[model samples]
Target chain A: MNNVNLNEDQQDCLQEIINVAMGQASDQLARYLDTFVYLKVPSIEQVSAQHLSDTLKYEAQSVAVVSQGFFGYEGIRGEALLMYQPKDSDRLADLLGYEPDELSVEEQIIDLSSILTTTFLNVFASQIDNQMSYSAPRLLFSSNADNNTSSQSSISEHIQHNSFNWDTALKVKISYQVTDYSFNCDMILLIPESAIINITSVIDRILEEY
Target chain B: MSANPFCTTIAEQLNTGILILDLDYNIVEWNRFFAIHAHKDAKEVIGKNVFTAFPELPQKWFERKLSSVIQLNTQSFCSWEQRHHLFELSHTRPITTDSHFMAQNCTFLPIETDKVISHICILIEDVTDVCHYQTKLNKVLDELAKANRIDGLTQVFNRKHWEECLDKEFSRARRYDHGLALIMFDLDHFKLLNDTYGHQCGDTVLIETAQKISSLLRLCDQFGRYGGEEFAAILPETDLIGAVDVAERICKEIEKLVIKFQDKDIRISTSVGVATINPNDKRYEDLISNADLALYEAKATGRNKVCSAKEIEYILEE
Candidate 1:
């Protein structure tokens, strides 16, 4: 399991922030998709390399994942990942009125997924970061494939072994539900715990000034 | 003190529509110009979804403009010339104390206010007349482009156009690994025809000959007036044998035509040189030069005959 050392207050604050950010993200996505989107509070947990596959097994095997990097106060930097099951991907394609069968190339699929993920993440990051007067959120990277392969094995192994520094790890999870289309998936925003602490301190300082 | 009369006067005098929206996107103020052009009274539009007030706007366009303002906190503008909107408008957002937008030339600008951080302002301007005239100018330019490719006298492809055709055919031949043939022909003793029948009669014969040859050629084949008294044809996907046959046919047809000029019967003939392009050949100019050399050979051997580069090679060998 990835080590998480958050006190109750910090956990509550992080959960609230994630909730608001995800809500805003869902709203923006809904506007783009032209469909109602419902996102749920994700089940927060620490998982090891051995449990990674099991954790993903309950989710769809064929999934579209988007990842981007964020940086904030005091050297805070981490990656945000949005995952969608195959069914949700189909729904997304339908919402966009794109013929899935016609998009055969990997480059085309990645471009389409990245466009959506960038728009959503841009909104989510801006809303959360703005409260502390942070720098404008920049989208570092995005992909829509099960990219955790051999090269990422070391990082996965470290997480599974609980050997990574907890102070530098913070993970937030969000699940989506579009009941009208019967589609759902878990979205994960992973940050180093130390980065979260720094961000929280900034927010605390801003709140105190208010 | 009376509200600055300049604000009201300018707002009313503008020809394009202008509107000021609050943070909630409700109209805080509307101008007379918008009321006249949009066909809606300002009193009826205030406090309504700007989109609802302008239901004719495309949903995607409306959403994109609205989002740019709300999220980026910047003014957005759209031109009528970009597409035919109900009104040609420009939008701008104001930088003043109140969040307001002014539309000019179909653009919208929103001014931000402190209490609400009025995120957007828009401006609009109408440019329908300019767009219409621009379209007319573009059409004239297109016609001019067509005119540039045709010969003024014969209404056939000119020498300049022939070069373009040959270049295109050469590239196609190389790409498809197919044969392309160039045939160059000159009216036999054309200067004598001008001396005997007058230049006007000679010109008539040239035009008639061009018409007859063009009738025999396929749509994909290009025939052009190479210069005074000379013409060239680019036959794509045709080899030396096919080009030789076409040249002979054109020669026989021209010989049969008895042109009556100045009450005298004149018989005209042409000498043709054919060259088959090798797909491996890199330069089209070399191919044309080879065809011209063969044409010189045809004229030397006989005034009215068809000659191929291979035949010229054989004669030189002899």
Candidate 2:
């Protein structure tokens, strides 16, 4: 924990902010779906840029991923990924008012990802007291259990392409479950080394103000 | 050459199928590979809705993938393992296998305009050969496993497999408290026959004996070559009487075998021993040994006769 770029205090602070942001997002989602949203306690860990895949590893041929970029203050930006099982798409589509068929399921996934990313990033930005902007969410990369051959490379490439020269990453993982349908989704926030430094200082300022 | 390379060559000349769709899911571009494989002209597809152009495409899945790609502005992939084929293109590989449609690996990439994704491009790679080879590998592995369990000469369960079957049957009989019987038999004076004739004649006699024994066995009975000039049968749900009756029939049928070897009349007979499940028989091995002891008695009394473990028990008591 000490070796992590963010010390224990900063990591805890980040986790606290993420927990609050996740709660707000979950409540919003629960209201939108007219169903209960189960949220797992969020955890944040500092990982090397190259080791991001290990930190974000998902079961092969089992998950579909959607990611989008968010801009933070001072040249800091990171991507947020929402991953879920393909089989859950049917239930999700039904809940989101989309017909679960060959045509509209992927669109439903995007709609779900966008709503989640939007709600999470908004609360996170406001909690940290930083002005932020978000790009339209888009499908970054997807690989399933069957084609595991390229999944590792796909994740690595996505991280490498997005992470840039940032050496360390603070990976935040949160789980959301639709209680009625039993569908689960993992929301991963990859904050780069530069972004965490800025956020840590922001946490220090907030603590000092308190 | 046109100033715009994308318009001139890249999309049209790429080997893999390239399809561009606008935000409304209308087809904006169709490459040569897509046109040829799909057997449709680019002019017909360029401005039509993607779902309308390929009605057979999984519309919901395609729409979901496209929406995710467009919304996230990222690349997404679909391998043949999840869905065999995206397009309903007929298989065109030189060595076509069982698959009717072309196997594909599809990639959806967002095409951005002014920092906003205006269109999505789908890249399709024909992976029929990969799927075909994987299927063939599985089939070959299956056949190899079957070959390992079967005797090459007699086409019956090999010794190893027979032992496994006997152990399984023994446990089932004990668990269900049902009767189980074993029959152990050997050709009468097999070595003498082998010495008088050649190994070729001995092999023929062994194969014929196995055929006659197997043909008389019930479907539930398991028959296998135990070893050189020896054979065994496992009869589940059968008592000593039923086993003895089956053994007697096999002995009589084998006795009637008139195998012709180079125009010479070669007669053969088998001596059989029968044993049924009992409190004393703890394992399949114990049952087999009891049957073997009965077989030894049959050989001692005469060359061609049927002996039961109960008779051996009476003899031991005497």
Candidate 3:
């Protein structure tokens, strides 16, 4: 757990694989919502669990968050988190064909996040030659501005537990935003030290092939 | 399909509900707990499509959920809190539970055979008790929050909460330079009525008076019990004339109200003082003090009536 020092070739291979996976995820999301989704090139970095909370600059203080964990046969293991501000929840609910209210907003977010997370994780796992079993999608963060319950602490706890108490772990950020809309969602995948080793070997095989 | 005695015994005897479904969603195995809850024996459900057995199941969503589990080869969960219940099985204790359907927390685990998932095992745990208690707890918490902001006797905003609203209105008025008014009123002989009858009769009077005044005010008005025998209201976007009109309406309504308490009829009146925001006033408390001065003018001149702070200012100028 010293550091995740990926060589130039390995980084390129990982990024290329992530691009295809992320593209598939976006395509599925666009079709499901019937709107255009603009995605950034997914970035992979190594970060400590403690600094993980402060790692991303959150646009809104209160956000709706959906997280799901995936366990695979061939070393693909991690938790995927989808975060977005629920300010434009009315707009989102409209797209989902629901009257915008607290419950509808929550329901819509959970449904949309599951679609994004499932498509992304399934494609990513398949690319790495791994078959995954996904945990049910959970709305872990409260979107209530008045509710300042320890949401940050809960998220950090999930990150810590999923990282398996690794001193440092590889964090892959797959961020997206809707075109001509106010929605910005980021999907983060935390790969614990053990899973990273498995991924590295898979990467090496692909590298050997090319 | 294991014919092992221990596996069979534990599967049949264990309290937990268990069901195994193949990739095609055919019921490969249904344990005793599951069969009992689903109201179908193993022989009835086994080798049947789940949707065929339970037509109430949302087919499309269920199909998508099952496919996600199989394709990922990953375990997924459905909690009672999220979707209420997956199977919609009737509650076992119909007499005890108000719920028609028992709440269930289902776990979908892909049963891997040689690194290939052909079937999925679903574990359903009855969480009816948890949902019931959690709902009750949430209701109690909501009532507790309402109790903190409301006066139990009058059922209006209490003094602390009323003042908070006034402060907010005061700042909003200053920022937007909008019209804001305050009305303070108290029962003229509330103490005499309590002494003659009892505190319960006095309580009835306060409750009725508050209801009457609240009915007269606009939706934007914040009405509350300020103190003993006294009530206050913050009228947003109201001028002196509008404030006086509302005060007069409350005054006349209270004067007309006759509460038929137990063996007697009790009648009471209120002295209302109206005040508007002045340019010189530094805080919302100044508005309250001005309204208090107008209330004093109404009480000093005669008992049951409405007096305006503007009238007091005109008297001072003369």
Model number with the top TM-score: 3
Provide the global lDDT of candidate 2 against the true structure.
0.77
Q: What is the per-residue lDDT of model 2 for residues B211-278, given as tens digits with 9 covering 90 to 100? A: 88889999989999999999999999999888899889889888988998888999989999999989
Ranking by lDDT: 3, 2, 1
lDDT of 1 by residue, B54-97 (tens): 66566554555466446433233343323345432322322421
Q: Model 2, stretches more than 4 Å misplaced?
A: A1-210, B1-14, B20-26, B55-84, B90-92, B95-101, B107-122, B175-179, B279-282
Q: Number of the top candidate by DockQ?
A: 3
TM-score of the B chain in each candidate versus the native B chain: 0.75, 0.78, 0.82
Which stretch of 10 consecutive residues in model 2 chain B shows the poorest summed lDDT? B68-77
- Among all candidates shown, the one with the greatest lDDT: 3
Candidate 1 regions exceeding 4 Å error are: A1-210, B1-5, B19-29, B39-56, B68-77, B86-105, B108-122, B256-267, B279-282
- Fraction of native A-B contacts kept, per candidate: 0.00, 0.03, 0.11
Q: Recovered native contacts in candidate 1, as a fraction?
A: 0.00
Chain B of model 1: TM-score? 0.75
lDDT of 1 by residue, A1-210 (tens): 233455566566656656676677777767655678787766554444334435444332355444555554465566656566554555554544445443322323333334334444555556555411112122112223334232233333333345334423455676767777686756566666556556667556545555
Model 3 superposed RMSD (Cα): 6.4
* Cα lDDT of model 3 by residue, B24-65, tens digit: 889988887877778876666888898888787877667766
